[model samples]
Target: MNIEYITTEELSKRIRYDVRTIRERLKDSVLIEGIHYIRPFGGRKILYLWEPIERDMVLHSGHHTLAIPMANGGRMNG
Candidate 1:
């Protein structure tokens, strides 16, 4: 099946932020290049993969914004 691709504009609308903000603020810091977005056919146009974005949002949606590494080779907050 041919999967549908979404533009940064679409992601902005879903996340309730300006498209420019995503590119300027969250593009490299939060959203990795190939993981969250791509340049189609080596072109400059960027398309975001919605599935990964949704999964990451779900995975990270929480109270604590810190990633405290535990001594047991894991992570926790105190």
Candidate 2:
């Protein structure tokens, strides 16, 4: 399998978001660890996986639903 890894700056350019926003706002909330990014060799540097991020962006782009997370790990779409 082939995977494309990208830096935070590169991702900011591609997604048209500020690097600061990605790092502060979206890092752990929207873009999850392991799924969206990885710390190579357990280092502090984070490399994002392009394919999954792209796929998720496309998948969620058309949705107008609001998801509210429940305490029991369920989500309610409004």
Candidate 3:
């Protein structure tokens, strides 16, 4: 797949999510590694992959259960 890498601000505009919310809450919680985002060149800067995220957004847009892993090895559901 031809994936497009986007910055937090760009993603915010595309997804209508606040950049702060994405950075503070959604990052690592909903948007995960090797799936939603990546750190290119092993650097601190993060680049979000749009395709997977968009796919998941559409795929999970129904009344299905959603779960996300927490940093403390627990899970949160919605």
Candidate 4:
């Protein structure tokens, strides 16, 4: 796998997310350690792996509608 390490600024540009939001919210919530990002040599700086992030974003995106089951036993596609 050709893993590319990018800084917060670079990640922000690629994902169109604000640096502050990335640092404050997405860093630990959406972007997890060892999976989405890494702290090199146990350092404080965080470097994100672009491949996994992009892949998950596309996979989780609303590309197809799924049938959701309701409490009344009816299926609704949304």
Instruction: Candidate 3: give its CA RMSD in angstroms.
Output: 9.6
Steric clash pairs (candidate 2): none
User: Of the pair 1 and 3, which is ahead by TM-score?
Assistant: 3
Sort order, TM-score high to low: 2, 4, 3, 1
Reference-based lDDT, residue 15, model 1: 87
TM-score of 3: 0.76
User: What clash count does candidate 3 reach?
Assistant: 0
Q: Is candidate 3 or candidate 4 better by lDDT?
A: 3
Q: State how far residue 75 of model 1 sits from its true place (Å).
A: 19
**lDDT by candidate, in order shown:** 0.85, 0.94, 0.91, 0.91
Per-residue accuracy of model 2 over 1-78 as CA lDDT, tens digit each: 999999999999999999999999999999999999999999999999999999899888855467788999877887
What total of clashing residue pairs does each candidate reach? 0, 0, 0, 0
Extract clashing residue pairs from model 3. none
In model 3, which runs have C-alpha deviations exceeding 4 angstroms?
63-78
**C-alpha positional error of residue 34 in candidate 4 after TM-score superposition, expressed in Å:** 0.6
Off by over 4 Å in 4: 64-78
Candidate 2's C-alpha runs over 4 A off are: 63-78
Candidate achieving the largest lDDT = 2
Which digits, one per residue and each the tens of the lDDT, describe model 3 over residues 1-78? 688999999999999999999999999999998899999999999999999999899888853557787899877895
- Checking candidate 4 for backbone clashes, the offending pairs are none
Instruction: Encode model 1's per-residue lDDT on 1-78: one tens digit a residue.
Output: 565579988999998989889999999999998898888899989999888888898788853466688789876855
